[model samples]
Target chain A: MATNQQRDTNLSPDEARALRFDVEEFNTEYARILDAQDIDAWPDFFTTDGFYRITGRENYDAGLTIGLVWCDGRPMMQDRAAAVKTTMVHAPRYLRHYNSNVRVTGVDGDGTIHSESNYLVVETLMEEETRIFQAGLYIDQFVREDGGMLLKSRDCIYDSLLIPNDMVYPV
Target chain B: MPDTPFIDDGSNLPLSELRWPDDDLTRIPDWIYTSDEVFQRERERIFFGESWCFVALEAEIPDPGSFKRSYVGDVPVIVSRDQDGEVHVFENRCAHRGVEFCRDLRGKAENFTCPYHQWMYDLSGKLMAVPFRRGDRGEGGMPKDFKLEDHNPKKLNVTIRHGVVFASFSETVESLEDYLGPDNLEQFDVVFKGRKLKILGFYKNRLQGNWKLYHENLKDPYHATLLHVYLATFRLMVAGQKSAMICDESGRHSTMASAKDDDIEITEETASQMKSAFREGMELSDPEFLNYVQEFDSPWTVTMQIIWPNLIVQRELNTLGIRHIVPRGPNALDMYWTMFGYDDDTPEMDKHRLKQANLMGPSGYLGVDDNEAIKFLQDGFKHSQDGEGIVKLEPEKEGSTQTLISEASVRALYRHYREVMDI
Candidate 1:
């Protein structure tokens, strides 16, 4: 069983390394879900009270603006999925996500893991062909749940100054 | 040649020339909407030469060392906040070899370093460092005559009003207020409302239609009632409301406005389809979404302000935003929509704003319909080059109080387009 000290802010060296590995795995799985267009499964990765945001790197760096997609809880994410799947009509396309350079920054007092990673998404459409849709960094916070680690908050800060195309899906 | 009063000739004019014929009301010349040469000329003479394009809101870069990279026409630009909190707009290209300097979209950095050769620049765009300047070889170093101060990106004339920032490539363009004029300026202030802003998010999309088509769509109130039945179903707007589409002093800017008529009743058939979760009788999830909060003394629930060239201040229901259109080619345009709410919104109000966000964006019910309509319209134009499209609704008066079914705003846009493009 994990000790109270290991669960809280202070972690043994071995536990710290394990927490880093857990965050890296979470980042990879999250990207996989989005890239696969596993729309239903995407929201399950978040905690009940989670924040999911996708903002321009410019806005995040300046620390003065909000995201393009800002959701404070899982219900907002679920609502977004329902709308996109049922009501919205868009050109058919496939997305490929590439995430790398993941690093666990630290673990907070409540066993929440803070991590960051870099990402690039390439989208292919009928006439436009495959192009760089967006390239950015993700600043994330994860909490240990019953089954696995769930994302408490995730902020995707995109570096592509000019969005190559519409941001229809979550990053 | 004598100055051609920018009229329509109603004949086979060169793609470079445009003429407005007195007989034609709805149809415009095909060349104006579908010519590559015309687009190139617009980029040269209009976007890159004169117009003041919106770069970023001042609220986005409130702190020192903050920066964002954007575009003016097709030209890459960087809007930065200096140590003193002064905002500046400069060309994004490096002075050395014309490479783009700031690759990242945004960040707070005391200086920017060019990745190509390690030439560093301060936030003020002044050259700060050169990595190999005093090398061991000394012979392969930069020349002694190469001055750092001379390498700053070209500065542009900029203006800020109600926290929104505007920049002009031409130094002699009219003042921001004069450029917007009274009719459109008032609408801008009403939506922006001089408050410190908390940017909610951004929605960027690319349309295959000409940029003007989007402008025409916004100016045309005709489609809102028909193409988007959702509006009528929700009783947010009705076909019998008193509305007007007015052009600004320059005729380049316009406002399509209509007040809410509470007296108008929603039929049972329409109301059943729009039964919102938050309130049964209320069309929108939030009552504010239906409320015209009246920050200003305007008598309109909806004010769509078309700033000349690209910026649009959209004040619809409770959603307030700025739409910036970047023309990619004759057949394509990229739209960037920045959503904003005031700094003082309560948690519940913020939630309300988020829920109403559904009214816009790629997945938005209204926005998706507009996107589909714009594409179909472009397809129609592409297939039918021989026939003219009609814009002659409400012909009795040149500009009249708009009906829910009128396309007068579209006609006004073309009239203004001819003047600016010297068509």
Candidate 2:
């Protein structure tokens, strides 16, 4: 469902047409990699100085600089991936993320594209009913790297105020 | 399921029927956890009983008209600062028909008008006016003998210590100082200590377990080193560190503190003894978070003070926070975590606090396990009915512990609980 599609927020006709295809491919691949549980490769899709965070909309909307996971660079993200993949002990589960309403919101003076998409993640734990795990806006800042788009920053701003239990997997 | 009309309903039997296994406060019956009756009793005997419950920080409502919604026990209440700079806390329910007046979480407002019938109230919870109180052209309205004074919302006794605010439902609940006892009050003053509080942020979560389990989780001190390997891996709070679990005289309040031991020399024997805690391969690529600046007067790196039923004052190094436990029902409890820092925190000190946040919250290395472990305990009781738990750590049976590895505080919590609930 998240294939190559042209989506624009506030951009010229030519700029929107240029970004829609490559940016869509980058985001689709990003989601596919995480959904496929190849989580170790997550840090590779970002620049060496990339930033990523998972936070509730309450803190984000209020301009509070706090997050459930705040990693300033790729090395930190790699360490997080390592921990979640190996060391953490949590309930057995499966997760599927549905990302829609993708759009390029703005372009910075430095040619970095500010993009956003609505996401819904459904988690199915062992022998339990599948439920909507998290719903949020993935605010992304994309930069071109070696002929392909790489994320400079990604903020998962969830609307759900209260976390149900342990968020075992990174959203 | 249909046959049971009131399943899990805590039947209010005689107080004698709910007897403890013994008088030593060592064993905790499982029924107290799953009992609806015990929960209801707590709401009345403790929440509405003589206990000071932490409501909000005075800094949250710095302005005269600022107000924030909070929970006192299970009842909804509004904490607002009036025009005279006096803090006021009252039940959010309208005296008329019991409809909730304020729905907003926090806002600046001089008046709270119930949307149900358009009844208005001032910041002091005094009924200011009513829509069409007299009449519409003298036809359909209130009777001539209506008294507005009789309809005022229930006002609570508000206490402000340092920057923290507390409210008590009972008009005669002992002074906040006496209620906390001298030792606990001194520890309470340690974090609060008259320094202006700067609001940082908030993180809230709901666990599907009884509320006391969370209290016990904080009090256990035993779970810290064993369950959360991150504390051990980073050498933040190992069991080998100098720690103390101090309980008040009545065991109603307690403070569990752990110091960073700089003197411990690591030998081969010590390393092997600590092998289970420290994983060899796990390393934080960015370990700048481990850097600690001595902020407090005390040498302890981590201190968690349980203010009886509702409040948890926590200081994990420089990252300070308060946890407000709101028991939703017999089976579910919600935790409102307000993360804050002192007003005069240096820029580097602030960043240090934010980075060290990795140790707590939904995704925190140590905190992630504690939240889920509470669920695991609640799940344990599902298999058997009328079963109980044993908390006999520290064979001396003292309520306080000299080491981190003891259930002394857990027993102390129930000891006070039994006295309060009179079970």
Candidate 3:
């Protein structure tokens, strides 16, 4: 019965603007790494105890815990990265990740930044036409690390009712 | 249902025209995967025929007046709990003009009204009111013999066993208990043993392959230790483990049961047989999620059951779910997955289930491979000439077998499929 709770942010306009820019930069690098299929480097974007999950909006709205992909910690995420890179079998494909409308929602007392963004992933198989694979929202929490931001938690809530086939790469 | 005929040539390519590629169940014809005529007959002889199809779990619509849109073999239907708390299943198609009225996937509705003409129906699908029954102050009214009871949406016979709901178009179809047969019923009860279930979530995806291929996939355990490298590498379900390809009396139903024998090392001979699947040194960074608590009263750690025409009961270690296969056409199917857990599970147990969830769904470590492999099977037929696919493993046996390297259950399935489909 996990749920995304609403939070009220009371950030100064200048502070909010600066934090939003940093989040946008973080997402840019994150998407670049994924789109390039550098799956091994995917875990570097997260904290040591980072949480990651990709669940359908229907499940999210219903407050259900089951996820298409759920990683409790950075170790689990690294395990997933390894599996996708070597063990898991799938078709050879190219993916493009587009993240936009980044919104810095709140800054926690522990310096954790709550944010959300719209994401769309388009995929192309060998000799097949490209298609919209997923359209979703990334509800995230970021922690400042080494003067940059690292994702402490990311819950990708996809809006597509039916995934065309398999989501080979992480969103 | 709009019966828009795809081929005007006839009513189900005469049984004589469609033949099995071999006398025994060694080879499967390519046309069976690519022919539209066979698809039409499946609709008539299998789906709408005398078979109990899984519609929705009672947990989905737990409250009175709650309804969830589901399908019984590609035919859209609404599974509703009436105000009296009785469950009902009826076609989503409006009795008035054939418009699929139940658009929402799930909700609590006192009654349903067709948007096309505002033809209202109660939660039990009894036609409550017709928009112009008396016709605008009696000006252009009906002939007055239009009975609400007679014009209700087609209803299906529903039977529930331990909160698992099944609906059937055939009134004379055997009870769900008998239909599942004794062996399949025993495997089924291991999961649905009268415990209250909490629905975890859902995953819907379309597989670009025939629906039957999915049944074949689970029944054919020969591919499990090979295609799914993660399973083989992690010692989850490798060869030489205590496994069985079990089929019910009807052969259409089967359970691929296997116990995790992690203490036993894979022999060098088996390792060579596994080839690339047996990764030499790969390991999981967090192996705690692979924990298997002895929750069920069964010996097997995995029990993947294909319940006849539509349902797949998956109980792989701690992860539990049911996959409903909705055949769209000969080449594709829509799989609706509903993951669940016992209501009495602890918070830690819940977290463990989610962690293990990565092994199943569309992006699962194991499930993704099966989806891709089935797609490859369909693609091969689409691109090549009419040829037969071989299913000769454990060729001597035709029903159940005790070894992992046998396709006996798959052959058993085709044996029953041929009889039911009359191909």
Candidate 4:
């Protein structure tokens, strides 16, 4: 469990380290599901009211509202999942999401943990060389529900300005 | 003079080698995509020709001193607004050393100073200052004959229509209204109807195919019903629907317009053919984004306008955007997408626009398919040389058509292309 500022004041260094480890575990599991291409299970890692968006660092820094992919809630995420799985026509490819530098940045009064990590997604298209698809920071807010951590919001802000071709899968 | 008669033509092949396959618009040679010579000629005769290329939106550089980095063909340019509230388009290259000095994509800059030598340029692209004009105490400096006016960066003739900005390299280029023609200009005003625009955001991508293919993709509306299942299944745009591929008199510009029918439903067979686990249903769990609000006075719900050489005005349902095609070479292009909405739009309408935007851009549901198809086309041309693509659908018709099954617009584009390239 994460701790708020009031609770964090009394938390020992070892306890703080454990909280970070927990967040890392959650991120690792989330990455595992995404890299596995399990689109159906992808939204399960998020709460029902989760806000997910993938935007360029330029737009994020400039306070632009649009995103490459924007989902206001889990229903929208499911819709995206269904669309990508069924109707979208794209080349067959494999993606691997590498999440690192996971750190619990802060805790809200209601025990909502804020964490961020660097992510790099490498994709290998059919008969094409593997390339770095996206490199960005995952600014996330997590909340625990029913003894499990789920994303309340995930903002994938990519520093790689120009996307090569099209991004078939979400970051 | 005869000793140095052989000169660099920017490509290995001479101009004579590049010629149209025949005096027809149906057959397109593959060399147009792969040949460097054709690409070079296109840059000179078409991109930098008399066409009015889209540079920036007035909303982007709305205030005085606001500038945005853009491209007119392959040339980097700065689209800036002067203190007097006039827009200017100038080459990004520095006069001293030819460095692309405007590094930032967009910002408020009083004057542009080259980082290489600090040669200063004002908002209107006039050379206003030279750091070492008389040297540091008159030791090392530019020659006394050097004049500030003589070394200004190359500027372009700018024209704005309904807040949409266009720039041209030719001094005597015709008016934008004449360039777009009556038919195309009528459609252009549908989106830019003198209302103020609010910049939503941008989606920039490097397409791994020739720039012209992007134009052809939109102009070739036959593939719209077949290639994109999302559009077909949702009945947003199908072959049976009411649509038209309207072209300008010159055949250079076109508008592929389509109206959506709400009652249309996906057939069970089409749903079963989808290779996914969730084949039982095709309806989206959240169809809020698919709801279209009647805003524009035009009959068409979707209008994709291809304006000559480098601009694509995309109005898919309510999500409006301008796709600026910048040719990197013959093989690839950098597509800069500027998504926007009217400034008077309510918050809900704005969110609806953003929600609907998922159907376009680099990562869009329908957009990914076109990108992949284009890549496949480029690969086909690269791997198998000396082949010509056939665009013979509705061969008798040349310009605008009522049917969606025809490739008349594609043929029209090539007709104009051949005239400009003079091949």
What is model 3's DockQ versus the real complex? Answer: 0.66
Model 1 error, position A77 (Å): 7.6
Interface RMSD of each: 6.3, 2.3, 3.0, 5.0
lDDT of each: 0.71, 0.79, 0.89, 0.86
**Candidate 2: stretches off by over 4 Å:** A1-10, B1-16, B262-276
- lDDT of candidate 4 at residue B270, scale 0 to 100: 43
**How do these models rank on TM-score, best leading?**
3, 4, 2, 1
Model 3 misses residue B375 by how many Å?
Answer: 0.5
Tell how far residue B73 is off in model 4, in angstroms.
0.3
Per-residue CA lDDT of model 1 for A64-139, tens digit only, reads 3455666778877776665455444456778999888766667877777877778889998765557788888878
Question: How well does candidate 3 match the true structure in TM-score terms?
Answer: 0.96
Model 4 TM-score is 0.94
Residue-level lDDT of model 3, residues B1-423, one tens digit each, is 222334222323554676676576888877787778788889988999999999999999999999999998889999999989999999999998899999999989999999988999999999999877888875996677878889999999999999999999999999888898899899999899878999999999999888999999998888999999999888889988899878887789999999998886889999999999889778889979789999888889999999989999999989999999999988889999999998999999999999998999899999899999999987776655546789889878988899999988888888888888877
How well does candidate 4 score on lDDT at residue A20? Answer: 80
Native-vs-model 4 lDDT? Answer: 0.86
Docking quality band of candidate 2, CAPRI definitions: medium
Per-prediction DockQ: 0.17, 0.51, 0.66, 0.54
**Candidate with the larger TM-score of 3 and 4:** 3
* Interface C-alpha root-mean-square deviation of candidate 3: 3.0
